[model samples]
Target: MLSLLGLLCLLHGIWAAPGDLHSLCYDFTVIFKPVIQQWSCEVQGKVDEKSFLYYNCDIKEVKPSGLLGKEIQRTNTWEEQNEMLMDVIDVFKQQLPEVEPKNYTIRGPLTLQGRMSCQCEANGLSNGSWRFSFNGQIFLLFDSKKRKWTVVHSGARLMEKTWVNDRDVTEFFRKISVGDCRRWLENFLVHWDKMLETTGPPTVVPNAFHAKATTIGPRLWTLLVILTISVLLGT
Candidate 1:
């Protein structure tokens, strides 16, 4: 019974899709201080029922600067992403203090005009470049290497460039960018190129398993015991 309980606990924990948000629509409200402006960003995949593979990024209240109409820049180090996002937020708080919270919807990448650019390069080799635009409901992404426009929400390709979509693009993009459009664009291309070529979609082969086992073993045993005790007591 104890073993069964432990197994059940492990199963439950693992069944929650143990990663970030992928293939899901993400919406969040951010408070711009002082007068309190509520800015919301909604990122969803495709509008037309027929083509569900694409994505759109829309910001309400403000036109959003970094995402569109900025020169493309790349982060020198991966660790700097968080700092960059904080800077963007700080800028927003400083610039826009008191705008009423209103639902301003911008669709697709046609009417909206701006250039949010980022280049991913490593070892002095340029991997690719990315630009994002919004057309009321859809967020359009421009890929320099592919030299095409794609819906940012689509997953078949790593940002629509390669056949690798391991990480939750939306979640990762949000975390890395922190509502700053440029960093989001920059970080996506950076990680896509850095990981896709080297790591190649996380593996379970012994080497990978061994590394995870070392980190996860202690936690698993503790969880097993806790589950067993909790279940036996019917608590």
Candidate 2:
């Protein structure tokens, strides 16, 4: 019985999905504050002095209504990806907080304003040399040399590859840039790039999530066994 209880405890602990929102708030809200505000846009949920914190944030839009504008443009360091993803998602939830959060889609070779992208407009808007316009999209790029995940505009390009290595990074881009439209993206990447050290890439697990499930097999059997022992001993 004791052995069974120990095993149950271990399994239960292992099965449980641990969370540290406070830690998240500390790392993202404090350390990566600028990153989120820089990449993403904000949609205020009734702004006031009291609700200032909850007013606007970098997050995936709640729906068609919350769409701010679109992922206009950007670039990022090849090394600093994990920090980018965690920070971006934290901001996304600030606006679209949900129980079972479903991550948005990511595509590659995505030509912004090109006929390829699902949300691409007929007349693609173009920056100096980056993407055009894509709203409510998320892009993810993996650098084999750097071993990091980078988030950027939906149709961003590097190495002259149209969509070969690049994936859609709309929301990830949105989570960082909010109000300052004139922010120099290349300068930002240069500043953040200094912190990059050689590190393995982060693994992305899709669909499969760690959720709580009731483990009653042992509990139920234990009760029966205990009852049986009592009855047998009494008899």
lDDT of each: 0.31, 0.26
Candidate 1 whole-model C-alpha lDDT, 0 to 1: 0.31
- Model 1, 113-220: lDDT tens digits are 222233222221222333343232333454444444566544213223321232343333333322333333333332332323332333443454444543444345
Tell me the TM-score of each prediction against the true structure.
Answer: 0.22, 0.17
Candidate 1: residue 150 lDDT (0-100): 66
Over all chains combined, what TM-score does candidate 2 have? Answer: 0.17
After superposition, the stretches of candidate 2 with alpha carbons farther than 4 Å from their true spots are 1-40, 43-134, 142-154, 158-235
Write the residue-wise lDDT of candidate 2 on 19-78 in tens digits. 200000101121112223333333211100111112123443232112111111123332
Model 2 weakest 10-residue run by lDDT: 20-29
Off by over 4 Å in 1: 1-30, 33-76, 98-115, 119-194, 197-235
lDDT of 2: 0.26
